[model samples]
Target: MASRVTALLLLGVVCFGFAAAEIVVDCCLRTTDKRLPLQILDSYIIQDAGKGCDISATAFITKVGKKLCVSHHSKLAWVKNYINILDKKKGGHQ
Candidate 1:
C-alpha cells in the first residue's frame, strides 16, 4: 500500500509538471494578461472595438460559457468578468 501510494504521488507530480509545461498564447480577448477562453474561440470584439476584433457568436458562447471548444479553460472568467463589469457600468449597477 505504501509503495502504491508513492507511485500515485509520483504520477500526480509528473502529470502536473506536464500541464505546467504547456504554452499559452493570447487570442481575442484579455483579462489581466491571459487571452480569454484559451481553449475556445469566441466572437471577435474588435468590431465593436471599432477595429476588427469583432466577437463571433460561436466565440462569444465559447468564451462566456467556458465551453471548452478546444478543451482549454483559458478565457474562463474574463468573459464573465467583462460582462459583469459592463452590466454594472451600463445599467445593472448594484
Candidate 2:
C-alpha cells in the first residue's frame, strides 16, 4: 500500500515536470494570429502561473460569454485601447 502511494506521488511529479517543460506560446486558444469579429466583454493579461507576465497576449471574454485569447502586440493602437475600454466598462467604473 505504501509503495503504491509512493509510485503515484512520483508519477504526479513527473507529469507536472513534463507540463512545465512544454512551451505555452498561447494558452486556451488554438489560433491567435488573425483577428476575429468578437465583441469584447472583458480583458486582462494572462500570468504564467507566477512564472512571469505575458503582456503580448490578453484573454478576452466575449459579450455572449465565450472566452478568447487576443494579441496585444498590434500595429494599431486602437485595438489595445478598445479592449481596455471594454474592461473598464465591465468593471462599472469607466
Candidate 3:
C-alpha cells in the first residue's frame, strides 16, 4: 500500500510538471470572447517574432493595438497560406 501511494505521488508530480510546462498563447483582444477568425487574416501583417509563447510562433498586431500570438505548427490552411502571402509581400516573390 505504501509503495502504491509513492508511485501515485510521483505520477501526480510528473503530470503537474507537464501541465505547468504547457505553452500559453494569447489573442490579446479587448473582450475575452471576441475574436476575428484566422481566415480574415489575409490583409493583416503577420510578423515572425523569432521568440514566442512557444519556440515556434508568428505574431500580428491587431487594430485594437494588441499583439496576438499564433503557433508555428498551426494546422489551419488559411493561417499557412497567409504566412506565405506575408512572405511574398516582403519581397516580390516567395
Q: Work out the TM-score per prediction.
A: 0.25, 0.41, 0.32
Which tens-of-lDDT digit does each residue in 12-91 have in candidate 3?
99999988774644522221223346433433433333323224444544435555555442644555665666557653
Alpha carbon deviation, residue 79, candidate 1 (Å): 30
The best candidate by lDDT is: 2
Poorest 10 consecutive residues by lDDT, candidate 1: 42-51
Instruction: Determine which window of 10 residues in candidate 3 has minimal summed lDDT.
Output: 27-36
- Write the residue-wise lDDT of candidate 2 on 1-94 in tens digits: 9999999999999999988884654454332645656454544444334344434455666666666665543543555676557657665111
Candidate 2 Cα outliers beyond 4 Å, as residue runs: 1-40, 45-55, 73-76, 92-94
Q: Give the per-residue Cα lDDT of candidate 1 at 62.
A: 45
The most accurate candidate by TM-score is 2
Model 3, C-alpha of 76: deviation from truth (Å): 2.1
Ranking by TM-score: 2, 3, 1
Q: After superposition, how far is residue 24 of candidate 2 from its true place, in Å?
A: 8.5
Q: Please provide, for model 1 over 1-94, each residue's C-alpha lDDT reduced to its tens digit, 9 standing for 90 to 100.
A: 9999999999999999988773433334432334453244433222122234323221233435443212122344565454454455443221
